[model samples]
Target chain A: MARVVVDVMPKPEILDPQGQAVAGALQRMGVAGVADVRQGKHFELEVDDALDDATLHRIAGELLANPVIEDWVVSRTP
Target chain B: MRIGVITFPGTLDDVDAARAVRYAGAESVALWHADRDLEGVDAVVVPGGFSYGDYLRAGAIASIAPIMTEVVAAAGRGMPVLGICNGFQILCEAGLLPGALVRNAGLHFVCRDQRLRVETSDTAWTGDIEAGSEILVPVKNAEGRYVADAATLAELEDTGRVVFRYVGGNPNGALADIAGISSADGRVVGLMPHPEHAVDTLTGPSVDGLALFTSVLRASATT
Candidate 1:
């Protein structure tokens, strides 16, 4: 079995209101030195070792993230 | 005329959408998400709700349902399809429409009577209304902001595909205050507001939304 992790984030040009809200809260809580915050999704999947990287990429690109508004990175976990 | 109103597991507005179709003097057919058949309905309406609990993303799962495969095919042949609220998101996710509906700029669920200007009445869904006329409808959603890349945005603007433009004030911070848009052929349309909920004055802000339903019926009759 193999575990894959996909990290999806809104594209740089897209607005991230939820992330901004978190940034605001952090400011109120007296946290500093933060440049900005952008929210995203993280997905972990367990699949057969035979699953190829191309197939995994298709899954991540087609289902895990919306290409129109977000970008995703897939990495295998040990 | 017969119109199909699709119901996914978490759909909340199918009944209301069906009722709106009936009020427009058409028969409403209930369609299931898992079914591959369209039941020979002249048009389809994908209504609002958190389908699949909005897992992954709102409208993401539902957009790939068995029914949508048929919906996309039918739409390709120029069949009229109207997607409201979450349905709009599904249509975008399904690539039936251009752009994506994202978190509202305010980051809050907005529910209110919104005024929108009819940008173009050339589409199947807005044919009964005059272009530039303003209509009041109920807008409700957390992720109602419409977003597209700059090129797509320019194309939509250049081609006059924007169907509805927020009139009074933009409720969701959608780019260009776009409340609704249509496909290149104008047979497919998706909008964030709840036009189904506004077909009657008793339940909605105005009877203006009835025109959308009537418009499709009129389009069907001529075709």
Candidate 2:
């Protein structure tokens, strides 16, 4: 069995209000060193060792992340 | 005319949608998400609600419900389909519509009587209304902002598929003030606001939303 992790984030051009709200709260709490924060989603998948990268990519792109507003990174996990 | 109102597990507006359909002089049929059959209704309404507790992204899980397969098939054959609020999110997730509905730009749930301009009357839901007419409807959602690639926005604008636009001001920071849009064939429509809530003046902000249900009924009568 193989494990894969996919991190999906809003495209840079899209607005992420939840991240902005969290960042604001942090700043109010005097976290001075904090920069901007963008919220995202993470998914862990367990697949057969024979699963191909193309199929994984398709799953992440078509079903896991919405291409209209999000970009995803899929990487195998040890 | 008969209109099917689909109810997912967490659907909150199916009853309201059916009420609107009945008020518009059409028979309303209830459809279950677990069932693949569409009940041969002339049209369908995917009402608003946080289906599946809105986990794993809004509408992401509900879009894959068994009934959506039949809804997609009916839509492909030019049957009118109206998706409201979370239903709109499902449509986007189901690939039946363009764009994605993300968290509200204000990071809060907005609920109020929102004014909207009827941008296009060519679709099955808006044909009864005149172009550029303004109507009052309740808008309520936590994640209702519409987003899309620039190219898709351009195409929607160029093709006149934008069915409704926020009139007074931008409510959820949706790009270009778009409130609702139609598919390329103008048979499928998805919108963030809750038109079903405005179907009765006694229980709603106004009766203006009844036009949407009547429009489809009128269209079916013509054909």
Candidate 3:
């Protein structure tokens, strides 16, 4: 089985309130040097050998992530 | 005319939407997310709710549901479709509308009686309402802020696709006070306010929201 992982994040220009809240909590906890934080989604898929990279990418783009507000990265995981 | 109200797993306003349809003198049909059938309804309404528990994004998960495929095709063929609140989010996620609904600027779920001005009366959903008419309705959501690229915003302004604008005060801090918008052909509309909730004075903030459903019925009659 091939294991694939997907990381989806808000666009760079979009506002991320949840990420900012997390960053604020970290700052209050005395964690320094954090410029910003952008929260995102992570998904892991175990695919059969028959599923090609193109199919995986299609799933990520069309089903897993919304292109309007999110960008996704797909990679093979060990 | 029959209006279809879709119900996803977590849909909360399907009943209200159907009631609004009936109040406007149209038959209401119930559609299921898992079903591919559209039941030949003349129009469709994607009612509000926390569909799919809003897991990935507000409307991201519900956008790909089986019934949306038919809705999208029908919308492309100039069928009227209205998306309210979470329904608005789902429409944006499905690429049936422009922009995306994000978290409110205050980062809290706002629930209140909201005032809105009808900016355009060209849409299939707002044709009965006169331009510049102000109405009160209830809006409730955590991710009701609307955003799009600068160019798209400009295009929407230039084309008069802006259907509704927030008035009195901006509840969710939507960009440019835009409360709702319509497609280029005026067959589709999406908004963050709950019009169905305001259709009855006995149970809601006001009866102002009934105009939207009545407008569709009137438009259907003329066409």
Number of the predicted model whose TM-score against the real structure is largest: 1
- DockQ leader: 1
| Model 2 clashing residue pairs (backbone) | none
lDDT of 1: 0.96
Clashes of each: 0, 0, 0
Question: Candidate 3 regions off by >4 Å?
Answer: none
Candidate 1 error regions (>4 Å): none
Please give the distance, in angstroms, between residue A61's alpha carbon in candidate 3 and its true position after superposition.
Answer: 1.4
Can you write out model 1's per-residue Cα lDDT over B1-223, one digit (the tens) per residue? 9999999999999999999999999999999999999999999999999999999999999999999999999999999999999999999999999999999999989999999999999999999999999999999999999999999999999998999999888998899999999999999999999889998878999999999999999898888
Better of 1 and 2 by DockQ: 1
- Per-candidate TM-scores read 0.99, 0.97, 0.96
Q: List, residue by residue over A1-78, the lDDT tens digit for candidate 3.
A: 989999999899888889999999999999999999998889999999688889999999987887767899999977
Query: Ten-residue segment with the worst summed lDDT in candidate 1 chain B?
Result: B194-203
lDDT by residue for model 3 (B1-223), tens: 9999999989999999999998888899999999999999989999999999998788888998999999999999888999999999999999989998998978889999999999989989998888989989999999998999898899999999989899988877788999899989988999999899988888999988888998888766766
Evaluate all candidate structures by whole-model CA lDDT and list the values in order: 0.96, 0.92, 0.91
Ranking by DockQ: 1, 2, 3
Clashing pairs in model 1? none
DockQ of each: 0.93, 0.82, 0.60
